[model samples]
Target: MSQTRSDLRTIQPSARIALLSDIHGTSSDLDLSRLRARRLQQAIEAINGECPDAVLVAGDLTENGDREDLAGIRTRLDLLNAPWYAVPGNHDVGPKAGIADDQPTSIGTAAYEEVMGPSCYTATVGPVRITGLNTSLLGSGLPEESAQWRTVERDAEPLPGPFRILLLHYPLFADHEREEAGSYWSLDPEPRQRLMAAILRADHHLIVSGHLHRPFVREWRGRALIGAPAIAFGLPPNDRSVGWMRLTVGGDGRVTAEERPLAVADEVR
Candidate 1:
């Protein structure tokens, strides 16, 4: 029996994925409104030029999680040549622990979903199975956090694919694969260990995360952990260049990833 075109695609030997993170689109409340979204436009153009099979945004699509900001970003992303998926970031989901007193979070689960649907979901592209985790729910203590955990459990079921990738907003840890989980820049302790255990159990191949605004990569427990840089602003003392990461899944279940930086004269943004 001849396989259908769709079936052939499902069994394709390779897939190219573009990972974009921390767009932080323009907001009146935010300074450098010109810098973030404008820089993101350049990244999107480059990704379109590459013509990847799919694009996954690690999160922080908006500076303030404003509906208007999200809508604008949606339009910009619609211009991309490939289908894209995303999880919610701390900014997108709202409320930072240390800054909660002065700058309260504006978007909770409802607001985030109103624009982007469920914060967590499983998507299949070619031979790859990608699961997006809503790391924003990690320490929120909101009712939705429990709901997200349930969703994670349900989606953790192994799918038929050589390449399985998990997309997250916060890095499992800021530095070192064996560091303590709670470091003010990663998933809260309990959730981090829980998710880490799930990935190890599922034998997931890769984990891509953003939020530190710096790029990094490490191999831990037989899985690849990639920290995607921000298209908006990067912390100092690092490259601080605006960029994204590329992941290629090969036929034998092998995966390779590389960081691609946008040509920027100034890394301040």
Candidate 2:
């Protein structure tokens, strides 16, 4: 038994995965949407140039969760030739702590599903398995306002694969692990702990997340954790340029992630 392919297509056992997160629905964090869109376009072209089998977005597709952000995001994503996957961040879902005037995150789960496919789903690329989970909960103890959890859980079972990957909006560990503020709001810490247990139990290669709008990577418990920066906004105090991550998964199933900035001069949307 050669044991080659997986569920979706022929399992080649290795594939390149370009990871993008926290776009925030704008062309750029700078002014003038023209150059910003151009930089974003350039980044996508570069990713495709690497011959990756697929692209992944961890979350925060729009700024302020506005409907218009979809337009810019769609434009950038359309330029990609390979298949891609994405989920909503806290911003795209409206107010994270509910509305200022008592509004909810909206039960438009179906709408998100239709617009960007399933809110929480799984995709098989050759021998690698990529699964996206929705971590933006409405209430403190809630899972999501929808059944997206069931979908992710159903498809999240570990497969005997070359690489197992999980795409989530929130960091898996507790926010207290890093900073005091809720910078990692996308990760409902409680549910994430459970999800982390599941992934560790299954022995995955890595878990990727965004929403902090800062690119970071670390390894723990034999799991590689990767996070991408905001493609639209820069962090407070305006230190360095914002960027995305390019992941190269080798034939031996090892992955190397690089975070590159979309630094085009005077660009913003």
Candidate 3:
């Protein structure tokens, strides 16, 4: 049931890909959980209406990395009409070292692979090459970290596509590339620089991620870094409407992205 690189269907030219993130699904019947589920369902319906060629989920698929929660979210994602891929957010795979110690320890790579397949993979979608990474393992020093780094190096190699996308859970930085790290919201400086080096070598055009629970776009060394809005809920000091992103790649290889908001019933809030 794993959708590996070879198993992924080759999308046609002029692909329309739907981007969703931070679903935070749970099996419990709490009112908030029900609201999140409803929002996810609405997002799926909207994505199917767009008839995207593929879908990329940016992670945080569950409130916790529990097996039941992961399975529940996977079942909801299956409703998408198009082929879909996902990376694990901190919530889905446990936090990195020195982060959220009060919560469960890092789930390790194997537990995640059991439900989500390989933690790192590359898929071809017409003119685009999408590389998904397991950010949770980036600085964790787990054995899997070395293997994932190899994959990152391989990403720089020439591929069939002119456009490359890096999909992961954490934002490289909250504001600027030179900003200080150790903030709970962004990747630490060491791994951030290392990853950026690989991205520069690969000339990745776009980097998409979640975990900020807000939507914003910024440019880092000429590449677009998009913070996908949370499908479960949005943070304050900005529009809190839950939503998804619509990314379109033209036959000419021009890529554009738009944010589409999904409305939830006020009573549910």
Model 1 regions lying over 4 Å from their true place: 1-12, 29-31, 95-107, 177-182, 237-239, 265-269
TM-score of each: 0.86, 0.80, 0.88
- Residues 24-56, candidate 1: write the lDDT tens digits: 886784446666666888899999998899999
RMSD of each: 5.9, 5.8, 5.7
Highest TM-score model number = 3
**Candidate 2 deviant stretches above 4 angstroms:** 1-12, 27-32, 95-103, 108-110, 138-146, 174-186, 267-269
Residues 64-149 of candidate 2 have per-residue lDDT tens digits of 55445565677679889888888777666643442242334545444455566667766777767777766665234344544655
lDDT of each structure? 0.74, 0.64, 0.78
The digit string of per-residue lDDT tens for model 3 on 1-269 reads 11112112233366777899999887665886888889999999999999998899998888777777787788888999888999988888777665865454345456667887887998876667789998877787877788879998877864555567899898898777776656778888888899999998887767889998888776566667778899887886355677999877655544567889988765244
133, model 2: CA deviation in Å? 1.5
Candidate 2 whole-model C-alpha lDDT, 0 to 1:
0.64
Q: What is the lDDT ranking, best to worst?
A: 3, 1, 2
Per-residue error (Å), model 3, residue 56: 0.7
